[model samples]
Target: MTDRQITTTLTSPEDTCALAARLGPLLRAGDVILLTGGIGAGKTHFARCLIRSVLLEDEDIPSPTFTLVQVYDTRQGELWHSDLYRLSGPDDCVELGLTDAFETAICLVEWPDKLQDLTPETALWLGFDAGPQDDARNLTLTWHTPRWDTVLKGLVA
Candidate 1:
């Protein structure tokens, strides 16, 4: 299937959170989201929003930077939030159970460049950038598989 991409400018953190909340319900097992952005680009915030939305609660979602990975149990299944920034190589990902989670859980991966070729081909890629406004952010969502086409379309709609 052809790849699909959508870009949007979020003026505030609430806008970003709302976007994540809308997308969260559309996600399912075996879905992988690769988040790419520089520090303070709001990747973690976006992830937390998504996770909390899926859980349908105001849970405290923590960044996985220091701990590497955090797993959350939801009614739908397991959701994995992983930060690969601290890993030295892709092999470390296997040791951390990322490979397995990528196949079975809804994975939100930050700094996925650390995964190199190990990154899944079917993953949805999100690239965030600082917007013109100080508190705004530009988000680009790239879908590599047709599996996410409808959901992506709905998100932009």
Candidate 2:
């Protein structure tokens, strides 16, 4: 797997949404995204933007914090959003059906550390950090999949 880092700052929720909008077009059905960050790091906010943009709809996309997972169907395919913060362990992954999701849909997982050995090897990782102050946020994206490299190039362009 190849490791690369991309650091960028987002000023507001709109800015975060804009970045997600730019990246959303590159996602495919089998893509997986692992989001890592502390509380208030804007992981869910970024994901909401991503899925909504991909669906081309301006609907309310709530964080699946308690429900654990949410699915959206777009013309491209299914988009699955999962928040595993409340998971007991990797054993819970099968219950969530993540392995199958990896092959059938585009997945965005928050609190990815909960699934130690279950996250797809080709999954793209997006790490978030709180900015200096206010509502600012810093995000770093990395991926090992060849498809991700192509997407990264488009994002960087």
Candidate 3:
């Protein structure tokens, strides 16, 4: 099937987090969400909110910038949040066990360009960009597989 997409403008950081939390409950293991955006585009905030929404307790969710990857145990299963910006190539992902995690865990990946050919065909793609307002962010969600169709059902997302 063809790709399906939805675009929305987040008026503020809270609005961005709200959207992330809205999708959080629909996730399951084996789901991959590729987050792409420039610096300060609200990627980390959205990921932090989504991860917290699935967690049973409150905890700090830091950007996996220098750390590369952060794994959390959630109600759905293991959640892998990875920032591949520092990686020189896709081979680094294999060494980090990210290729396996993408198949078994609920993954939210930032700087997914580093994944190269290893990028999953079933992954949901979220692109973030700056909006007219300083605090506003334009978010676009895109998917090629039918998996996200069910996840986005009823939400008109």
Best by TM-score: 3
lDDT for predicted candidate 1 compared with the true structure: 0.90
Instruction: List model 2 lDDT by residue over 32-149, tens digit each.
Output: 9999989988899889888988884557788899989998886679999999999988889788898799999999999988888887888889998988668888888887667777
RMSD for all candidates, in order, please.
1.3, 1.5, 1.1
Candidate lDDT (C-alpha), each: 0.90, 0.85, 0.91
Model 1: per-residue Cα lDDT over 16-61, one tens digit each? 9999989898999999999999999999999999999888445778
Residue runs of model 2 more than 4 Å from their true location after superposition:
56-58
**Model 2: per-residue Cα lDDT at residue 141:** 86
Q: Name the better of 2 and 3 by TM-score.
A: 3
Worst 10 residues of 3 by lDDT: 148-157
TM-score for all predictions? 0.95, 0.93, 0.96
Clashes of 3: 0
Best by lDDT: 3
Q: Please identify which of the two predictions, 1 or 2, would achieve the higher lDDT against the true structure.
A: 1
Clashes per candidate (backbone, < 3 Å): 0, 0, 0
Q: Global CA lDDT of candidate 2, please?
A: 0.85
